[model samples]
Target chain A: MGNIPSGINTPEILVDVEKLERNIARVAQRVSSQGLKLRPHAKTHKMLEVADRQLTAGAAGLTVATVGEALNFALHGVPKLFIAYPLWINESQAERILELMKRAKLSIGTDSVAAVQQMAKMLGEKAPKVKLMIEIDSGHHRSGVAPAQAVEIADAARDAGLRVHGVFTFPGHSYAPNAIDEAVNQEHKALAEAACLLRKAGHQVKRISGGSTPTAELSDNSVLTEVRPGVYVFGDAQQFELGRTGWNDIALSVASTVISRHEGSADIPRRIVVDAGSKVLGSDRPAWASGYGRVMECPEASITALSEHHATIDWPEERELPGYGEQLRIIPNHVCVAVNLVDSVLAIHPDGAVERWDVNARGLNY
Target chain B: MGNIPSGINTPEILVDVEKLERNIARVAQRVSSQGLKLRPHAKTHKMLEVADRQLTAGAAGLTVATVGEALNFALHGVPKLFIAYPLWINESQAERILELMKRAKLSIGTDSVAAVQQMAKMLGEKAPKVKLMIEIDSGHHRSGVAPAQAVEIADAARDAGLRVHGVFTFPGHSYAPNAIDEAVNQEHKALAEAACLLRKAGHQVKRISGGSTPTAELSDNSVLTEVRPGVYVFGDAQQFELGRTGWNDIALSVASTVISRHEGSADIPRRIVVDAGSKVLGSDRPAWASGYGRVMECPEASITALSEHHATIDWPEERELPGYGEQLRIIPNHVCVAVNLVDSVLAIHPDGAVERWDVNARGLNY
Candidate 1:
């Protein structure tokens, strides 16, 4: 709505610092008031600045998806970190994790006995240095052992001389439309059952972790000691479509220019093509998602198609179409994947000065 | 499948050198024999080594999607470069283009008269230093003027003292099932009509560039002076699904490890989760695509879903599922986007030696 900042190139991510802080504070406050630990997933922003904001808002620690991400945070002196993924740790990765443990309290997730045994074999005597969280399959069914199998994995970790700290699950199925309540319920039941099983098996299950952005607000604190919600820091189109966050709450957007515009005729609809496409905005359109992404200015407009560097937006008939070279802010379908595509994001500070935040863990998928 | 090489981590791209060379050679021979110059799009691999191979294989130049990509190749001493996207150049970009033109012959695509006028004003006396290509909409309609509007934009560029190179159109509609022939026809007709209109308007149209991976093999060389195909070097699942490439033709794949596996029960279907997800393989699934990606070793296996770092694969019933820590090669839905996701790719040489090829133009989307 305002002037697109000069010197900021098209198809670049711009983080609204004010909105980001609000998003952070709001979630932190909610989690804290509910008496649950907030360990915001660093995979979303991957920026030290965003992690700092979350930490400053009283996050217990940072949850990472890979050892590379964990090392990125730990090297920056983040005191506590967790790799919340069932990692099949290789010899080289084991060495990195050992080095990482020296800087921070590192923990990783494991769902299988073989993975734990391999982690132990790779880490050897240093296995106890890294704690393990047995992943539980709530209902999302992507990864994690069944609730009954939590004891088996915990026993395997214990037999491998690793510390079984707790259990964790990712209620990713909550992302679908009208599935939030079911996902929350399953997450609660799974974590509760897994914790009970581990306790009965003579293991101290102190930490129970679960929560995606859609199910974060409705997390059962009675079962979950902490929640890891990454996308809450920068709401995406998925969260918006799932009615988790409103348009005003979306903090991250791609600043792109209209490169081409076609006024509608009787046969074809009016549309404007923007420079930002899957390369910058990402192509993570779920079946429930409205489009590839959303136009911040025109909420009803749908980005019907996207090429590598071109997004074709079906312009609403009632509104005047933007001309060539006109800049528009676009909310990506998935902020995490979009953020991972670029080296850095332009963070617009509260004072209107733009600062570059390096995506320190940009492509650290391994 | 052979052993997954040591030292290479999971969820990483592996480019088979022998297959890559063969793929490159085949395409080069086909295009050269047709009497059309080959300008391979660097957006596919984005590796200088791959570009060098393409150049050595008789490619006339490299076509890029952005000014940054053009600069990347130019700095690496690539003799000729073309930014084939309709760029809305700002002052900063104009400065970069001027600097870029000093190192190599540069041409850019423009669909609007306003864009050409702005280019002229931005470059001023140096406008002629760069060439302009009028992009015609050949039914894809993402960006580009209609065939009839080519003369208007060409006239604007010519009046502004810019050299009108020719007309180019991307037949992106060729990416669908049973649509390759129609796309080729539309591309030929559109380019021919646009070239005719431009010639009648007293402009020397030397180059008529058009061709995507799907339509490249069937391109009408009589009307096309040069053809640009990005994904021919490294076939992806999309190309495989479109019947444009066979499984053996795919030169690039993501080396992923199975982190979790589940056998089918009465209700739930069997699936395995790999480390390669949207963050690595990229989430570029068209509705017509079978799945998120494909397992190279198991062609029938479908990557049913993808999280940021987990790909849930639906393994075939006949095949024995890969165990945890077992590595698998995964072909992404789109090779270009997958290549852009990482900083480097592991190029498996003909001698079986692995080399790291830096994606020098990885995130040069701006």
Candidate 2:
């Protein structure tokens, strides 16, 4: 609709403000209307500005993946922070968590009893203040204790003087083709049983947290008090391919320029190289993800392959292809990993002006 | 072989200095014995310390992938830097290159005539001083012009007042399973023909650069003036799988701590979850690569899957699985991508001391 900044760099992250606001409001409305607390995961954008906007839109708190990520948000005065993924609290991380706990209400996820014990010993007397949520396996089977085993871990956490929160699980298996509804059911069943176990153990199960972008809409919110979907705020190609969101719902993409064009032989498709590659767009092609990333304008083109600095998009024989220096918006397969690949994002306002936001919590995997 | 730093952070990059030195020496000696210059690519580690070590080990110059990377090395007083990438010269990047050119002798890759014209116009009078390497297709077909068409682009570069030095081709296709020898032959043929084309046009073909870690040793130096191998100094799982290096050659790995251990059913292998995942190790499996990465000590444990913050490793029945708090060294599938994912790398000295070296050129895709 308008010209980008003349001096803008290629292979850069760009967020359409209008679309971003719409996506945020839409998710928040659905969660709030269902009477569930919305704690959008910060691992997607890793920007404090995005967190602030979500908080402004009635997010209960922010959910992160690591202690370093939580520290980034805590430094910016986000009072309530939750490290949703199960973490093995080491000395450096525990010390950092101690500093963060003094500034904010912190919560962490633990899957194993030994990890809970180590966390308690690492934090010493301050462990009680930090809320602990036992992650239960909701059929994903990646990380998280079984629903039947949640009571033992919760009891052990309480014995170690840790504040036991309810239970949480990531319905990651929802990402597979035609598996969203089943994953949602599994998440609900897992959290419900895990919370029941905590309640039977005489512990207050206040938060039965569960979600993922694909299953957030299909989730049985009655069984959970909160939903934590990270990718819904900035829909990616994986979300689009799964029919979880429409193309209009995609807010973030890498603004890439056509760097080279190679004429293919009769048997091969015409190879069009773009500046954006794995380094900028991230290589997260889950079998179903539409060809690395979708070219927003050129739907007919299939991105055949990608190297570190070049994306080889095979253009249809009939469709007109872009020449060198032409720019394209690439909706990456996984927006979270793509955002982590950049230092900052260019947010283009409705008025067409752009502002760069620092990816503050980026590379905070520790 | 020794104790890891207990107080250090998890999901961190660790470089064994002794192993790293050995790798550097090995490649340097091989390249030197051939009477061909070695310009190690900085995209692998992107650290000043690594670049310094490479230069001290008799590397003629350093090769980088982007202008932002070149600027990082130039600022550190590296006398010569070659950006072996077909960069789309934008206004901001051109301005940055102008500043870098003032600091170091700069050479860049160009495959198209339009790109050459744009680069020449950006540099203006100083364009003649910048050596231009015409990229030729060597079966990879990712980027670069065909070997037969190299003279047209080289002549166009010369007409635009750019110093047409020679030709270069990346045998990137060598990374595939059992494709190294074929890719090497392709690279040699492409560079030889392209250099011959340039020389026929009365241009002095002083340099013929070609290499990739997989085909570096197999490369015919009689047809090439120099080799640019980036991953040799930090052998990854992909390189090891291709038989280019051994486990002992893998000097860098993500020092990740076990966060969770899930007991699997009879059918499923025992799952060991670590804090390091795609974010720390990078999402570059290349289909044929060893599942995500490899656990150095637990060779029988294969990393089955990786989410943003968790690496789900499948420990074979015969192997002894790790405990909840034990640490493992994860040699990533692609060391370059893994190094770029971090802010700094931990250099573990022989004396048991560790120092963090900043990944200065990380996220410098522009």
Candidate 3:
């Protein structure tokens, strides 16, 4: 796997080794200079190697979305993990969570009093109690209780004998370009208000966590102790659209081959079909995305549409079309989902050697 | 692993062993009765065990969407694998294809003359003499040459010394209700016309294949020698919405736990958040789909929207709401993409025994 050449593989994920290292170094340096904890979210690159790079670069901990993700990272010896999503604790899953806790310091998020009570019942007589973070709905009307109702849930969690660690919120609205500043400000206010309420209720509120990739840039570290920005480690289309990262900073691309071609008549420009399709690049065209995906070398050529095994592209008439059977590289709109869509990524080393790394956590969605 | 109880585990994916076996048996019987080869597309299950079951049940061959899928199936000793995608063959990939042909009977689809010529150049003396299938566009407006133009490509494939096996098309439009009849009819017409054109050109057409799960039941098998249907084994929300299959026929579901319960307001109607998000279930909401996803047991409930790590459901106030930490099963809109998003599936046996089968081809999209 390590001896293979990077450009030879078809429908393979290509991670620009240099760009990835630079992105990790930049994020780690920024967070460290601010005297804040950097818990890079594993939801973006659910790979142990990426997590190892972050930890080696001085990340305080790792942030994961599922108990399975936490377990994967913990098995690889990542000491501190935060299951950032509000977890549903059942009798069966509780046993898995307990096992994860035995390996690493675990903190889980919850937004309901019933969930806290359920966890308490499941964790009855356990040596170390699971740390709980109350999720507050800052601006994103998705999961999480309202900031005004945060105290009630915190009180309930504390009463259930679960250690109420702090309040956390995801400013998901920040993903939108115009909403970043507003979302971050709202997150600051929501976390501050929730912490004040929890403190007034006699609960020790230590950590105030909030920040997604879009919001992390503008987030006020003065209020929050930690930031979890997953996509920052591998800038994607969303980052490019939001102006969070430049086009050259994108580290991942899908290497595909031109399978079909229809030369331009007087009416239609040259149309080339690439083998990379929804299954390879992932059919994630956000409403705001320009196209299905963008071409790395030929940025002007947009991936107009995607079928199960075909990416339709309209090449400009002035530029010579890539001959059929020619290999082309594509930079996906959303790298996180694209990475999840492939089994392994071709890691191009600085010395021009290619190593294939199995996305060990590729499909551990459960 | 088979000794464990299925219900005790979390509800991400539930395998009804009886229903799965019944599905395989029913499809096999139908194909056998029609005197057509049954090459079940492994894209739906992506599991080696399921592929083995289909083959053991007397499947003639296996169908896959990518070279990686073909390689994975070939590794499991599933000989005679057809890569149903019109692959873009480059020099580097041609070598790999030649390598793959050594282990299995490799057949690939092509819609362009340039690709065929490229394969001819790369294959050289040790070309493995791959079988080529011409793809015809039957109103899907996706890949494949038009029905009228497929013969030209077929002649090119033959001229290049490749075996022109058959013509194939995907009736992707059959995914909507009242669309299957028209789509399948178009498929029949397209394949017939393509076959006739090839025969007129003094070429032997051994097969005429086309059938997706949506139109598999209604497909006209008189003109076709074989039919490929992937999702019939695991009916999903799309099948239910299109009226292709009833809810009772659905054999796969995502098991999720109610992690958050919004219990404060009567107007809210007890909203519960599950861990299944777009990443897990896939953000596939077809225009005809009822919602993002459907609750497996509570068919009336709808998954209104999905965040990265949360599924927001609006529960009915008339009935008792699912308690926090209560487990619920969800059927995704598209099962093929959903199954590919996970690493392994828990196979629940008839007597309630659970066995985990690695989705050996889960993300082998390359």
Candidate 4:
């Protein structure tokens, strides 16, 4: 896509149409050719247009992080959705899921036997059948049960009158540098083990799915039937730093104006302050991740720190820093977090026309 | 207020009426007794009801961070407003500010002579007189000009036919563990010096304001004519750790459900995973902050880490960890950010009635 004009609002997410289409097609082709289903995560973009494009590009379904996101997509006529979170089925959520099941084929992740039993009780007799996936631990140490324990939860869901649809896990450790290979290995082993255990327990394991953006290339397609990657459509600074992608693959960036430029000593590193801060880019600096974000134009320049509404950048000494009112595109460390910060984004098409796309599922954590 | 009913929603902000009233009255009394104007930052709650309470409690005006926030407050019938950020005055922002001035008395912050000149150009012929304040650097080193240079911009604004309204600064560096005293001293020195310079330049300094939540109590009221402290209304983990607030002063928290509880090994601490994550609490962990947020029921229990939709809490060994489906209140690291994360908050009244209050200016980042 062409460069964004300065007429629109600053500190806004800008989608480059050409790069987005290419990124969508690329991931879709790779996953489809490997005989694996492409179910791109809706938590990344959450825009109906982007979801339409992914579905049109051979995605089998959409993966969401919350029930509200699933509802948002279902309302827009997405046929299939999987809420890939170990969610607590509260009364309101269970009732909403019952309504959502009428619109789309609903699948949810469950890590506990107690939650599955509660969901079953809430669903009662008249509810439609819903698929359940056991969340298996893939060495992320965040959530999910051990691979050996996955069959127990899957069995519990099946016993409670829910359809068991196999297992899934997140390779969250892959976000760090030098950890992609290890995370990929963990994903393959955990998924394979979970599938084997579930099948032995008399459950028909149809969908054994696990894949993050960085580990997708090394994913064991032989055992997996589906791949879910969110950030591949919008390559962030974290992915770029891990050598998972280059600048050309970046489809989305935050367009920020240089509100103030600071003169600094050598120790401080000459800097410029942009309007985009933690409120826009998000405060998600993993200890292993360097800087806040990478500048799209000059990857050498790093967003050193962030206040509420100001991003302080440590510019390179070799080049001149931007002046007041100069706009720059910033690739945030986490695209999922950055996309949630704004209500809508300015899409700069290849032909230079701009359109707005609302983040329909933003702030839908409940 | 009573404990949040489990029937509402998870990862939602809950406001306690009893504590909220106390916090508001306490700040209003302290600022009024000291002969300083209490214009608490509206960027914290962004709710009209909270602004109404603050105004009724004895606030002179409301302080906002952006033009959008200013307009939001103005439309809510707040008589006076101040945009306490060195904002870039684009044509659209200028038009909005001009429209807002018709509804309320408005003032804006400016740091650079270039920006002030540009503002004068866009706001030239037909616009009414708007107050302009020069932002003085009070050791934050983020935005604002030097204390000595404040007079130059104040003079330029005056020459450009705008009403010159003194100087202000933010002690943002006060968020660290032991830096409150130094930051308070810096705020006093900078605001006092800037006022003196403006007076020396034959300009009347009506509003010499500077105070963050941490430094609000330690401010030298003799030097400050007004103070703007946002997070005081909803005390957060950062304030509680810095000894700026007591546990009783915390009026707002996120109600999250324990989705899964994990048994730990030697390296992994005993943990419970909550549904409230960075998307709800916001990812604003300062290096000095102990954890992502604090458990309201057990302040010692720290949120060890966070995913996009899950807060992993490492509970204290001595205390019992919450099991699945337990609803717990979470005090985030930064209240300002957490407030911006949600569209509406569940306000628990003194009579134990819970009502929804819309965050009117949630994403007014522009």
What DockQ does each candidate score versus the true complex, computed on alpha carbons?
0.79, 0.74, 0.47, 0.66
Clashing pairs in 4: none
Q: Supply the TM-score for candidate 3.
A: 0.91
TM-score of every model versus the real structure = 0.98, 0.97, 0.91, 0.97
lDDT score of model 3?
0.79
Q: Write the per-residue lDDT of candidate 3 for residues A198-227, one digit (tens) a residue.
A: 898898888989878887766656889888
Off by over 4 Å in 1: A1-3, B1-3
Per-residue lDDT for B236-318 in model 4, tens only?
A: 88899999989888999989899888777786567889898999998888788899989988878878889989998888888
Candidate 4 lDDT (Cα, 0 to 1): 0.85
How displaced is residue B105 in candidate 1, in Å?
1.0
On residues A1-366, what C-alpha lDDT tens digit does candidate 1 reach at each position?
233568778888999898999999999999888889999999999999999999999999999999999999999989999999999988888888889988999889999999999999999888998879999988887898789988988888888799999999999888898998989999999999999988999999989998778888887578899999999999999899889988889999999999999996686668999999899999989887889999999999999998889999999999999988888999999999999999998888877788888999999988
B206-232 per-residue lDDT for model 1 (tens digits): 999997888887875788988999899
Interface RMSD in Å per candidate, to 1 decimal?
1.1, 1.5, 2.7, 1.5
Candidate 1, residue B182: how far the Cα is off, in Å: 0.5
Root mean square deviation (Cα) for candidate 2:
1.6
TM-score of chain B of each: 0.98, 0.97, 0.94, 0.97
In angstroms, how far off is A352's CA in candidate 1?
1.1
